[model samples]
Target: MNNLTTEPDMHTALWSLVRNNNKLFSQKRNLEKFRTLLNIISENGTIEDLINIMSIFLYGNNAQKELIENTCLPCLRKLPCEDLPKLDERLRSSISYAGWNINETTDWKQKPSLFELCILACHPNGYTRERAVTALANHYEPVALAIALIRCNDWVSPIRISARDTAVNIIARINTDELMKVWIVFDRVSHGQRHGDISLSKTLFPLLRERIPSNELHLQLESGNSRTRRYAAEVMWHTHQSLNYSDLQALCACSDPYVCFRTMRDILPRLDQRVRTKLLDLVKTKKWAPARLERLRLLMTDQPECMHDELLDALCDRSASVRNFARFHLKEHSDVDMELHYQRKLESPNISTRIAALAGLTEIGSPIVADHAKRWLKEENPRIVAAGLSALPAEVIDNCEDHILKKVTNHSLQISKAAYIALCNSPPLSAKITPYFQRDDLSERQSIYFANLLLLQSRWEAVAHAISFCRHNSKEVNKCGVFWLQRWVYGERKFWMTPSKSDLQDIHRELELSHSNMTEALMKEIRFLLDSYQ
Candidate 1:
């Protein structure tokens, strides 16, 4: 029979060699046989012959097997392509899919021979490059994903966005040690999301601890974004459980109110009376909401020696809520002497002292001060209301929108303008008052405030409308409109800026081609607005 079912000497010899001694590939004779199998694969022989030869070779020493599979098998499968774009789509698809299955198999160590073949097959085509990116992203190896993202960034926008999102996802999941690897990657790249970088760095803070570079965390705590400050405080708190006095001082002095409050609140019990008094002195001048600062006051009772002077002094603070927190903590922790001392500071003749006393009388601040603040919301005196504006809760200012709007009709222009400014601070105002631009009843100040908000949000339609009203006789209103328009064109301090000359020309050309009159009218408005500025 042609098949030679029982007497195929060549097949029997190769199989017997592999079976008797898996290390046979290291011998000169078996090495020649492996080379012959690779040659057959190169010449378009059956893949079955190549697979059999690979099995024999797989049992050899790791180094030699790697060499044959990496160097020889890849050479056998190399495709012929006249151009990258003309590469065979079928080959690319087959190779990419094969790589996925090979990578997932339990015998992955034996599959690099095949995986090398796949990588070589797809190296030429654009489709292969995109799929390679997907593979790199989904692969379990973090280092591999980082390399692929960096390599793919220049491909196209869709590819770039995919790579960036993948990089972010990979970075967020890696271990703290792996995070250091990613940080080096971060330092290597010229650009990445600033917020993302800060976040990743914050997460890796402990890995950086007490090393010379640990001071970098302190710097971030002092000056980075709010998220960075919050994370830095958390990391420092965990890393330095019994924080040194100097480190405590640094944390306590942080400009971010939350960070300062956390540092004082966590360490107050552990600190001596001297350190406690220092923390109390610092908390007295703070202007942030009281609930956060109240935790620091609670710690004062554990150090009774510090509360005597600290309690009396805090009872005289300008912020009534601060005084109330001090009193509550003292009453909860200290003896009667501390309470009477706070009461005496409350009764002092100084207006600030009287304000402080009133602060304690109502268990927070005198309800009367808040009532006065509410009344001053309607006051025509700018200076008096400005003080009240500092004390009023954001919610009260927000709920009193219509009342503040009526104050725009107040006799004094300065007071009217301040009232309008206050309205801009209200969260509900952006919703309630943006529609005022559509009405004819807009005042000069109201129109100006509306225009500023529109400019701030980059609302082009509103900017165009406000520019149309610059022709009104009121120079002040015209000036404000021109100011915001220029700001829109030039960009704000932390927002979008005006385009360059080339960009402006390109936009003007596009506008000219589509809507010539609209373009001309807009350009005319821009010119008039600019002249008004000068």
Candidate 2:
């Protein structure tokens, strides 16, 4: 046999096995090549390689059957059961029918690929997978059984039944050592969705709780995948497995957010005062926003006296939710002048702080917010200008309508967009922006914004503006015009100020000229409106 050490060599070996080319491998040499192939696959092959190997084992010639029994099956048994690759839809459908060909009377002596069969239990093909599940019955190799457990959630009905039944029977009689090996796969599968109401894990949890040792559960909690760690934490808590302060601290520091949150929620309350305080302090330093927010909540409810400083510090947290949470609780608990504090923060060099302060002051309805907004609008920094525009009150906007209108054409799209949005709220200011509709230099988005603003007005001129927008070069703007025209035509006619007969005739004339842009259906609706209204 060739060494098959390099990638191309490996590919060639796998291709030979797949084709079952007897010329390449004599009877003895085939066994050696098969052993080497399984070793290489188990060590470093990707999911594609595994699929290829399974194809050969399941359907390849029986020349290497003895080698597969002694070498291939054992190597497969050790393969970790995790999320499998998605198979092609065409292949899944095709193999489903192929499963029917496996004779029902085939005895165990004839089928030696038990581990391969276990993997096939999850094959994309439903019937093939169901047949795999049937073969997996009474087989308790740790990885094999775990794969069967995963099929409990299979989208197919009979496969789910067969897999669940197999797991139920084996779990009842399976020993602790085998169960331990199955634990990681089992815990992971439990978190996934199921096909029916039957959950073998829920039924088996108490049995696992009794049979699995405490040390093993702790090991799972300390280190594993997110799903396994989370499940371990739940099992430990529900089973009342005692965790010392260090264990609690480790769990609190877990990278997984839910595990950290769950530990704090379920376990922290019952700990001694000193331990809880230490844990809270530890969580306060963690960068995760949810954890920090949760810590603030715990402080507010359990230790209000210690909450004042934390609340003030949290007011500037990078996360908006954290800052808002702190502000909401600070109002009731602390007598500090929040408005004055926010006003001071507006001058801070940090842009985020300035924005947060502006938001807080706006929410508090501070009289000084409008003055700050006026100043921010004139600043060279566009972000500051945006914050000001967003916070600028409706009355303030009405007074500065001209200034706001000029900003709609600003070079900075952000500032222009903010100015456009500000003007949108003041319907009386819509006339000032009507001239902007003719400006060809505006971007597609700005053109659309202006068109939408015109649609908001109840006046007949707004309908005329919609018609004029139809001729704009941008297809999206033209589409916007067509949509609003349809709405105005189909909508209640009496509610809006009716166009004079001449205005109606003018709109009808514009629609006739816009035939290339307007859909036939829309033109029909417009014609119906004009004939009735005239």
Find the number of clashing residue pairs for candidate 1: 3
Model 1: per-residue lDDT, tens digit, 452-482?
6554543544454445445545566667655
> For candidate 2, lDDT tens digit of each residue in 1-534?
456667657756766764634655556766677778767665664555555555554444445544544544555555555533232222344345445244442344666367547545655657778877777765766766776777777787888888777776677777878887676667656766555467654566656677776667667776747767877766656644555565677678777788788778878878777778788887886778888888887777788877788888777676778888888787785568888888788888899788888888887789988899999988998988987898899999989988887787778888888988887777544566678866878887777777777777765666766777677798898888877777777674546445697778767777667777666787777677667666
Model 1, residue pairs in steric clash: 346-357, 490-498, 491-497
Off-target runs (Cα >4 Å) in candidate 1 are 1-99, 103-207, 210-212, 279-282, 295-299, 304-309, 316-318, 326-381, 387-407, 410-534
**Residue ranges of candidate 2 with Cα displaced over 4 Å:** 1-101, 112-131, 137-150, 154-192, 195-292, 315-328, 331-335, 428-430, 459-467, 482-503
Q: Each model's C-alpha lDDT?
A: 0.51, 0.70
Residue 343 in candidate 1, Cα distance off native in Å:
14
Q: Which candidate is the best by lDDT?
A: 2
Model 1, residue 516: distance off in Å is 26
Clash totals, every prediction: 3, 0
Q: Please report the candidate that would top TM-score against the real structure.
A: 2
| Model 1 TM-score relative to the real fold | 0.37
TM-score of each: 0.37, 0.63
